[model samples]
Target: MLAPERKANDDFVYHSGLKFALLPAYYLPVWFQAIKGDSAVESGIHILPFILALVVATVLTGVLISCIGYYTPFLILGICLAAVGSGLLTTLGVKTSAGKWVGYQLLYGFGLGACFQTPNMAAQTVLPRNEVSIGASLMLFGQTLFGAILVSIDQNVLDGQLANRLAGIADITPQQIENAGVTGILAMIPSEYHEAALEAYNASLRVCFQVAVVVACLALLGGLGMEWRSVKETHTPDDESATEEGREGGEKDGKVDDGKEEV
Candidate 1:
C-alpha cells in the first residue's frame, strides 16, 4: 500500500496543476478579446492551438505512462515546463504577435496536459482498489475547488492592478472600471486613453501569469514528494481476488478428477 503522505502530495500537485493550467485558460480569451480586438468567436478560434495542444498532450501522456509504467518523471517534467510556460506568458503585451502568443499557449497547454492526469493515476496506483473511487473524488474536489478560488483571486488581481495603473486617467475611476467589466472596460474609456488602458490591462494580465508561475513552481514540491512506483508492479484488489478464486476453482476441479479416477 502507498503511504498516505504520498497520496496527499499527489493531491497538492493536482490542485497546483489545475490552478496554473486554468488561470491562463480562463483569462487568455479575455486578453484576446480586450487587447487584440477579437470578437468572442474570434478569440475562441484563436485559442484553438492551445486547446489542440492540450488534447494531444493529454492523450500522449496517458499512452506514454501506460507503456513506461512510471509517472513520477512526467509529473516533474510537466511542472517544470508549466513553470517555464507561465514565465513566458508574462511577456505578453498589446503588441504581441499571433505567432508568439500561439506558441506560448501551445507550450503552456502541453505542459499542463502532460501531468494533468498523472496525479489521478498516482492516486489509483497508491490507493487500495476499493478506495480508488474516494481518491478520485478527492482529486475532483480539489480541481473544482481550487479552480474557482484561483480564478477569483486572479480576477481580483486584475481588478486591483487595473485600478492602480489606470488611476492616472482623470476620466475613469476604479469604480467605473469595476462596473465596466474586462470585456467592456475599453469602451468606457476615452479613445485617447485607450492605449494606456490596454497597457494597464496587459500589465495586469502579466501579474496574473506571474501568480501562475509561482503556483506552477510550488507544484514541484508535490512532484518531488510523490512516491516513485510502477503501475505494472501493483494489482487492484479485484484482480487479486479474481486470481485467487480462479486458482481455488482449478484446485477443486483437479481434486474431483483425481477422485473420479480412483473410483
Candidate 2:
C-alpha cells in the first residue's frame, strides 16, 4: 500500500502541474486578441507553438520514462522549467514581438508536458493492480477540480484589475467594460483610452502569469516528496502470481515423489 503522505504529495504535484498547464489556456487567446489585435481564429493559430511543443514533449517524456524507469527526476525538472516559463510569460507586453511569445509558449508547453502524466505513472507504481484505476480516477478528479478553481481565480483577478485600472477613464463604466469582456472591451472604449486599456489588460494578464509562477514553484515540494521507486524495479501482480503457481506445482511434484518412495 502507498503511504498517505506520498499519495498526498503525488496529488499535489499532479494538481499543480495541471493548473500550470491550464491557466495559459484561459489567458493566452485573450492576450492575442486584446494586445496583438488578432481575431479569435488567428489567436488560436498563434498558440499552435504551445500546443505542438506540449504534444511532442508528452510523447518524448513517456518514452524516456519507460526506458529510464524513473519519474521523480522528470517531475522536478519539469516544475523548474515551468516556473521559468511562467516567469517569462509575465514579460509579455502589448508591443512584445511574436518570436519571444512563441518561444515562451514552447518552453512552458514542454515543461508542462514533461511531468503532466508522471503523477499518474507514479500512482500506478505504488498502487495495487486492481486499485490503479481508482488512483487514476482520483488524479483526474483533482486535475479537473483544481483547473476550474484556478481559471476562475485568474478571471476574477483579470476582471478586478480591469475595473480598478480603468476606473478613472471617462465615458466608460465598469459595467460596460464587464459587458464588453476582455476581447471586446478595447473596441468598446474610446480611441484615446485604447492604450490605457491595453496596458491594463497586459498588466492584469501578467499578474495571472505571476500567480502561475508561484504555483509552479510550489509543485517542487510534491516532486521532492515523490518516492524514487523505479518502474522496472517493481514486479507486476501477474508476474508474482505466475511465480507462486510454479512454486506450488514444484511442491506438489515433490510430495508425490516422496509418497512413491515410501510405498
Strongest candidate by lDDT: 1
Off by over 4 Å in 2: 1-5, 236-263
Pairing residues by index, what is the TM-score of model 2? 0.84
Tens-place lDDT per residue, model 2, 163-229, is 7877766466667767886577877778888898788888988888888888777777778778786
TM-score, one value per model: 0.85, 0.84
- Look at candidate 1 and give me any clashing residue pairs: none
Q: Where is model 1 more than 4 Å wrong at Cα?
A: 236-263
**What's the lDDT of the predicted structure labeled candidate 1?**
0.80
- 57, model 2: CA deviation in Å? 0.5
